[model samples]
Target: MAARERLADDPSITFPGFFDDTAVQTDADGGVVELTGALLRAVEVAADDFLGPQDANTLCVDRHESHRYRVVRRQGIIFIRIDEDPRACGLTVPALHSGAQYAIGSDGRILRRLRDGEPDGSLAPTDAGSGIPVPTSEVGRSFEAPDGAVPLPF
Candidate 1:
């Protein structure tokens, strides 16, 4: 795609997989970030469609302005760095593997809890916090596992 045409997608903002053959980089705060293996796989699958063959498969993440978060590609996978202290939401990075599938949605809190389960050391996820609670208005949000999967509306 031409640069001018691409710019029309969203100028002043670059996203992961924006380029087909370039390593994505983000400059943000250093903090602890976590995700389940499932989520990582989903993202990987998603990238395969947008990124070119020469592009390295990875999502580099860093802090964003106003306490918001951003995701990018690096080393053949996608990543998001959670703020130690979140503003709108109390979302801490959930410890997850880099090889499983996950569901990403606007309601990250609900999705994270569902995918990561509770930190209390339990095998099965708890129903209380199992389902992530996202605003119905964000129902149109789409997501994919780090495995370069297709976009699924949540």
Candidate 2:
């Protein structure tokens, strides 16, 4: 969606002016910024992305030409597990990985690059006091221990 059309979707959402040409930006308080127009189009997307109950496969943000992404939320952090290109998310250099998981402060700044996530979307994320609470999804919540090759408790 065009920026103007996105602006029409939700007029209240304000993207930080820090996004110049690239998405990687540093906030005023020394926080790192990730996920810009390249990853998620804040305007064109609906309010659900911001305030929706994320599931096993949830759309993070649209990038470039409305690329949908599946995300992971753990330890109070959001991780991009998959992209439209089928490349892995949240690992290595952005150029090498095509696109990596995005991190941002609740106040509209980028969170510091902590570490790269695993292939199965295991991010090893930490709790940074961004004030945005990420609840544990039902996807892996049922698994208590492995019953042989089975990954679930049942």
List the global CA lDDT of all models. Answer: 0.33, 0.35
lDDT of 1 by residue, 68-107 (tens): 2234434433333222123323444522421111223332
User: Would you list the clashing residue pairs of candidate 2?
Assistant: 32-110, 32-111, 33-110, 90-101
Give the per-residue lDDT digits (tens) of candidate 2, residues 77-117. Answer: 33332233323344332433433334333322333222124
Instruction: Give the runs in model 2 whose Cα sits over 4 Å from its true position.
Output: 1-63, 81-96, 113-154
User: TM-score for model 1?
Assistant: 0.21
Measured by TM-score, how close is model 2 to the native structure?
A: 0.23
Error of 1 at 75 (Å): 28
- For each candidate in turn, the TM-score is 0.21, 0.23
Candidate 1: regions farther than 4 A off: 1-27, 55-154
